[model samples]
Target: MLNRIASFALATLLLITLSACDDSNPAAPEEPVELDTQTVEDLPADPTVTVGENGRPQGLNQYTFFSLRDNEIVLESGTEARADSNSTAWDIALQGTTIRINGGTSGPGNGAAYVAEAAFENVVEVDTERLQPDTEEALAIPTGSGNGWYNYNANGQNYVRPIPGRTLVVRTADGDGYAKIRIQSYYEGAPELPADRQAHPSRYYTFDYVVRTDGTPSFE
Candidate 1:
């Protein structure tokens, strides 16, 4: 009788231990939330004070530092931008037609970028190997008219316009997140006819972007 009782006790103890082990097992991790696309309209990038005779904006050579994570302009003045230039608070900086990411010679952040030939919405993934940080000799997003994001004086047009089908694939300030940007208009209010300098003021950036902050390359 004692032997049978001992066997029963042992079985009960084994079952209890098994149940405890099952209860202690950790739960599976939840899936990361998908990020949404964000649109920024009329984010001023230091509007020019005068329009030159050549129909190009002149004067007010200052950069407007913007944060993609915050989706806001962090600094608009040259002095303030210079003071915070080394920080990662701002991801990108724009002055006239020139755009600079936060990495390399531009700033202290890990920011980098590359101009993709694909359409904005079609670019669902980023190739991190192709990304390049800003440098004195060359920029990730090249400067000059047709070389980079915008085309200057294309087809005899005097005003600058974003090159169609070109999208900017950017590594955020933290270097962990990624974002894709499509420049809709460089003029304020995103005018239908951006070449009409009289009506459409230049240097304002209106763009659509999708940011993924979960440290993933997927923009979806």
Candidate 2:
């Protein structure tokens, strides 16, 4: 009888010890890491881009050329220019007259297109993971006007232009992913202000973009 009682006491103590251990060793909560696509000192941040800045970090100088091809961003300075392939030749291109994405047969998978948003500042998150090809919101922007992608106004003193304030949500070519682009400038390496047209040589584009290559629509 004493042995039986002692066994029961020990069992009860074991149960209590187990309970204490459970309470002391709770599971750790996971904290999600946020991703940003902004260029750092003219380079990409991480998991945000396979290719970082395609142009100079200080900014693209006049006539500099850049391209996004095969998941790599290439930048070079000089008078070299790329002819339009009209086929996803290059995923995207920047020149004096236009900022364009590949479309039609030249595009990847289904081809790439974009829809303009009110502004980049209004964007909080991109639903990239679930994005699909030929989304209804996409539009094939044209390179008609030399100022086709942006406009500038001198509010008496400063030259105001649409850049980060003008955002494009894109369905990338090959139907692989989604990217958000904010065109910062179209004149010589993306200068902040629009100087006198005669004073600034236009055509070079400086921009920022975040791409989600996972076929998802999330940019964050």
TM-score of each: 0.80, 0.56
**What clash pairs does model 1 have?**
none
- The per-residue C-alpha lDDT of model 2 at residue 144 equals 40
Candidate 2: tens digits of C-alpha lDDT, residues 1-220: 9999999999999999999999999999976545456531222211111233675223232222223324444433333453433345345544333444555533343445444545765554654443333333543544342233455553554343553454666666556656676766555445666567545444445566666666655554
CA-RMSD of model 1: 3.9
Question: What Cα-based lDDT does every candidate model obtain?
Answer: 0.86, 0.49
Best by TM-score: 1
In angstroms, give how far residue 30 of model 1 lies from its true place: 7.0
* Model 2 ranges off by over 4 Å: 1-14, 17-25, 39-90, 109-113, 116-118, 127-139, 142-149, 152-160, 174-176
TM-score of 2: 0.56
Model 1 bad stretches (over 4 Å): 1-32, 50-57, 78-81
Global CA lDDT computed for model 2: 0.49
Give lDDT: candidate 1, residue 207. Answer: 92
Candidate 1 residues 142-206, lDDT tens each?
Answer: 99988989888755867788999999999988988899999988888897456567678888888
